[model samples]
Target chain A: MTLEIETGGVQLSTPILPASGTFGWGTELKNLVDYSALGAVVTKGISLHPRKGNPQPRLLEVPCGLINSIGLQNPGVDAFIQNYEKELSALSMPVIVNIFGESPQEYAEVATKLSNCHWVSGLEINLSCPNVHAGGLEFGSNITGVRDVIQAVRNSTNKPLWAKFSHSTHLFHLVEAALEAGSNAVVLLNTLPALAINIKSKQPVLGARRGGLSGPPLKYVALRDVFDVYSRFKCHIVGVGGIIKPEDAVEFILAGARAVEIGTGAMVHPELFIKCRNFMSEYLKNGSYESVENMVGLAHDDQHV
Target chain B: MRDSPTHFQLTITGNEKVGDRFFLLSFENPGVSFRPGQFAMVAISGEPYPLLRRPFAVSRTPEGTLQILYRVVGTGTRLMSYWKKGRKVNVIFPLGNGFEKIQNACILVGGGSGVASMIALARELHSRGTPYLLCVGTKKSGELDPHSSVFQNPPLNVKFATEDGSFGFHGTVLDLAEQHIHSFTCAAVCGPPAMMTAFLERFPDVNAMFSLENHMGCGTGVCLGCAIETRNGMMRVCVDGPVFPGKILLPEHLK
Candidate 1:
């Protein structure tokens, strides 16, 4: 029955945390679900300074999924500290700050700016952004670039580092590279890079043309990443991508994710954070598992008991 | 941007007329308590296309329910106007900021679906006992649902001006307003861009407020897709004010 995931000054009753950007800021959906219910609320990704983000057509709906190129549009670390930090300081759960940067130094700068802030319990260096076509390459798909950014951010902040990995690359190596760079944990999946076209307009439906796809359609791809990464590495796994239903959460937990992050799922159901909390409890009770720990990786356990 | 993912369930008569192109849906749910010129995001109960909640104005708020007289312009709105009773459709409402009225007398003007927002304004002005006149320009006199009961008259001066003399005045609604423009202190208009432009210029001295309905993403401010340039520079329509005064908006903004 032990479902504790406490470490590095962070304590979670369960491991599931709502992924960044998907949950908006906690205040937006405050009426839908109790903020205190989730293990933690990962704030929307913020940069060193505010960003307005890309032009129109930021989001496009796909089959049971969506492609979003929000471009990490946030108020930046200064504004986050000014407006959201004090409010987050009062919350009971760890307020993990998902951060993004145009360069490795910018990543370190954002982390450093938030380093002394007590509200930020951990740092999730977003290395999986798929919107911008940068340097003729993406930081997410490049393992070496990912390691450099992670290490730079690791050196700048004392908080636990969670590398958000993109699905464009291999799992074992990404997780391995993350750990070698001193990442305390790894969010096993981001969104799969995809494109959607408007047949009538004969042009790309999304303004960014390419976006990260997330939803029920990406659940299996996410689960495979979690399973494969957990099987290869010893670091904590934060399962993410396309977790729509509660059973899907169970699948991620069973696949060896210490915790699961609800990505685009929350956009459809804001109360899903509490929905998963209650559903997972009922599911654990029905399956004769006293707690989430008993269910973690049970899908791969040989005994199946 | 705050996203309260809550849906209100309400089914009532809309006083619908014309082709499936348009209809007046009225409902009195507690969810109807929105600002006069604000909008409600609606989604069809069951549909495959336009999964996002589409924004529409509260055409009228006459106790118990708010009405949105919407025309099917795209896949999103087409599915909404077809929703039947006893069906649970998810709708997030009363979203975004509305116009700031000085709590005085004003004039209300409407055309097409923009009538929805103008009607909502009349209800607010009437509730506040704010002196106001509502003029809904239509293609035919009988083609509308008598958009307002504000005036003592049953049809409330429901005027029209079809080119074929099938309606009132046989001209534009602005023609009717020319006789009454000086009577009102302020004006609020919602409708097609062309009409709004004309209304904005016609009532130069009087405060003319225009409610614009553009396609929005997130329905919240995060998308920044719905922005209009004004004297103060670019302000997000979804976050700032959906109903902007003609004085603040730039000349090309209406275009």
Candidate 2:
């Protein structure tokens, strides 16, 4: 009677979750969002150690999207688990921990620490960190490095693993490597590389020469990616791109995404997730669709479970 | 430091001035507060060019609203002009820090839209009951106030100047402030770079603070994208300031 989709052995109350880096340790937005409400809460991309991350001017606002090079600044995994583990345990919804590491060992080390924490539901292996120079996007692109990271983390933790893939021409290869290394799900398309310039100051806007672009600008591109991979592989598709409205969320669901992540729209609208969730509820009620699962790949017409 | 996607619906259509191409935007949210010499990064929300935001100094703080002055230069401005009555804009604001508090008698100098920020300072001074003089210059005083009806009780001793003798004195801000530089305890200036530099040169002894507009990523300091050359060293304008005192920067920086 209701739309219920199972992912990594858990049931999502909805089909929307905040993307990493957009949402902080959950307390910053304690006033805006309730953890019990979302389909799931993806924690900010956490690394092996506390990182000061990038210097000033890390975000650039485009027409409908924003470009960010935050450098994945977070208290390393040890500190993260120590700090967030208890808080995450209190949440009624699935708590996904997004982990970033310099090397395979660091990845495994952090995963192992979180493995023992009962509150952690799954791990999103960050194969893509655009701000750092070493083992950054390079790690996500190389087949051996990608597989090694997925395999190493998989070997270390029993928690369901979701390997995130960067959006590029060769994304299929990265997906292949992740699946080969045995990941439960894959997150398509990190921000595409972008930058800005100050004509008055005559300099590049982002301190980093390049950054990842997100928001409405990348909406169709992300859908194309989801369609590309979904058309090729029936594996779970987590759609992410320029989703600012409820209709946008519906579009992703129809395009074969079991769930969607809101990134750029979150920056422009902090309470966007809560708003999107409510609007989607209306979308579900007014239509013939009884549950979230019914709309999961509705675009393919004739294909309804 | 907490970023939210909240935007302000500024009624900027009727407020264009001689040099005011951009309208400064601020939230009407009661709790929202900002000081003089501070600015907001505003994009027309859907403008094609200048996809990013441009910085403008806060010009004034009306009873419940805030304002900034800017010139229409690129596509962002032309598109911004078309903004309807309730058009809400995406803004990253109260960004960087404002000018230091002025104690004793203060002298304020503004050139065109740069005069925009000093208005907020003037209001702060008014609220604090501090004595101040506001020397503003433009081509015509007509552009001084599109909302002139609101300023019957002003905060500072105001004077005006015009380039073609359209209104006030027929001279630049530096030429006018030359005789009165030492009269005030502090000087805060925001305007065309040339005029700001001239003010800086004239009042070498007065404590002078300036706000430099830089292209920024985040209004916070984490991104070193808004870099400015200072006597002490290079610092991010977004973090270090949109405001810095005269002594901290070299003369060449403006050049």
DockQ for each numbered candidate: 0.26, 0.15
lDDT of 2 by residue, A2-99 (tens): 54567655567777788776666644455435544478878877777777666556666676667777677676888887887777788878888889
Q: What is the CA-based DockQ of model 2?
A: 0.15
Over all chains combined, what TM-score does candidate 2 have? Answer: 0.72
Provide fnat values for all models in the order shown: 0.09, 0.14
Q: Model 2, B1-255: lDDT tens per residue?
A: 323322454444344333334344433443356667667767556433344556666544546555655556666667665655455566655666786667788878887766766777887787788887777777765656533422333435677777777777778766666657667888878777677777767677788788666555434443344555578766557657777888887666653
lDDT of 1 by residue, A118-191 (tens): 87888888886432435646566777777878899988988998888877546677677778989888886877
Query: How high is the lDDT of residue B107 in model 1?
Result: 69
Candidate 1, residues B29-98: lDDT per residue as tens digits? 6544456777876655333234456687764544445567677776666666666555555666667777
- In model 2, state the lDDT of residue A257: 85
**Clashes per prediction?**
6, 19
